[model samples]
Target: MNLKARITRTGAILLGKYVACDGFDEQQPIRVVTHVHADHMLGLRESLKKCEMVLMSEATRDLIDVLKSPLFLMAGNVKTLPYKEPFEYKNEKITFYPADHILGSTQVLVEDQEGERILYTSDFRLPNTPIIRSDILVIEATYGSPRCIRNFEQKAESVLVDLVDRGLCEGPVYLFGYHGKIQEVMEILWKNNIRVPFIVPEKVFHVCKVYEKHNKKLGRYWLARSEYAKELRSKKEPFVAFYHMAARRRFIKEKAYKIFVSGWQFQEPIRQVNEKGFVIAISDHSDFEGLIEYVRKSKPKLVLTDNYRIGHAKILAKEIEKRLGIRAIAVPPTKPKKK
Candidate 1:
């Protein structure tokens, strides 16, 4: 059950004989895509060319279908892995658990025939579902800094509701956020019975459909298109639009009030407002306290930090070692050697 970890531009690759890839890439024989985030799917297309098979959650496959991106490999190349079910691969058992990051995100658990367990948490948040014992734990440290810690979930609902209420009074309100955060905001609005036509970008519209397919209705939403934009411009009524951060500026000509939602708002020079709009503190990844708590509860014999926010990983590893007495180390990426 000897395992070695290798980091690539896409993500971490664990190798032995039956390789377990944590993210999208064809560098290994067996590739496991934890989620559909762009960073995790860097070499997805190229990997499909070299790898035997790529494993991912059914939800991820559905997401890829909706995106219709040429970057993704063919459907035949992907093998859907059901959550929490153990599947035999080569001489090892692999299980997928809900990662709580996005709609089909998973935390992979690989167990070798020799009873050695390895857990690779690609990206996760609070209220994780995986509760298994592991010999080695590879965890993400996206927000592994003391300054990043904040109880956002408990406060996000109220803050967003207030913002929406105020924005509706002005003109078309543009809410800028990522896929998962936008969905959460929509759900909050729905549960509060704030019935309003929400204009979403094309990608978000497709993602919402997948959520509905899973029976998670996000209320009334229309895709933002040329026709819809013209119609909105003609109308004199105020509306709400949820858009991806990249496309937020597109609606500026329509006099839409913009608001950027992200956890990074907490840091920096306290920029409450910009030329475009205001910034709000909302995040998906676990904060510093949550990261420490996870390590304490996992109780793994050895801990390996994710390459994301490597500086935070180094600091977090030291804290884990000092606080929990666990053998923690920030795994540095292998540097290329000069020929």
Candidate 2:
């Protein structure tokens, strides 16, 4: 059984013949999503234009639908498949397992009819995060360097609180994070007694519902739209508005205190937001050690680097082979430009 994977920055991988990891590559057919972060879903529009089928969890489909815009307009045809339901494509049976990276996030398992299985861990966190539990272990090591191997959840939360308490601004706390970490942060705020009427954009509101569907609690608030005027007017205290990065610009005009969240906060976008808004490096991707450990367990005959840290992937692939005698190969080619 021969397994091949082509990793793309949009988190789309050409797996075997007909299946794709994420994104809308004109070259592939079916696309499977492990998570809905922008990088993963960036190329989806083009994918739907060329492919016939797109597979994702029911909750993820709903969230994608909620995020209707020019980017996701072509996603109308996405078919919702329940987690663990093995489906046939290109004569291969593929299954999705929960990865606990964020809401509706999953780790993909592709198996041939002859029972050869290949697992793709697209931006995953092992042992789970605050809101979700890690099950099948295909993990992402965006932070998979030795320097990021410590538990920073408590410290991260305190940083947010400290910013608010330090009188950065006496206004609505606008925290910018993706759908993956929003609910977890909200739960943390609730647990820490951060009393505020949290506001979330409609898109993220739908995304948060999925977390609630899995029994994870978001905070005690709603959207800031006029429809929720009663709730908005009755707000007794300031609240956190968990939103997508795009929504940050508008919130800034509302005179609300702003915050940016992510594991990649040290990078350009998040860092830019930090200079203008309160920022924290609460990451969902596994650190370097986590990535090495998880990949070692799978024992694949070859490994593919999923486009973020190519140098790291190449180095780690060699280390895996040397340490375990299992051959690991990095998927070649850089990111495809948007057409």
TM-score leader: 1
Root-mean-square deviation per candidate: 3.4, 5.1
Worst 10 residues of 2 by lDDT: 129-138
Model 1 over residues 190-284: C-alpha lDDT tens digits? 88877778888788998899888877768888777857665874784666788888776676675656777776644442234755477777666
RMSD of 2: 5.1
CA displacement after TM-score superposition, residue 80 of candidate 2 (Å): 2.0
Per-candidate TM equals 0.88, 0.77
Worst 10 residues of 1 by lDDT: 330-339
Best by lDDT: 1
State the TM-score for model 2.
0.77
Per-residue error for 231 in candidate 2, Å, reads: 9.8
The segments of candidate 2 whose C-alpha lies over 4 angstroms from its true place after superposition are 1-3, 8-11, 25-28, 69-77, 129-141, 158-171, 227-237, 249-257, 265-277, 308-312, 318-325, 333-339
Residue 59 lDDT in candidate 2: 70
Residue pair clashes in candidate 2: 12-22, 13-21, 24-43, 24-47, 144-287, 144-288
lDDT of each: 0.72, 0.64
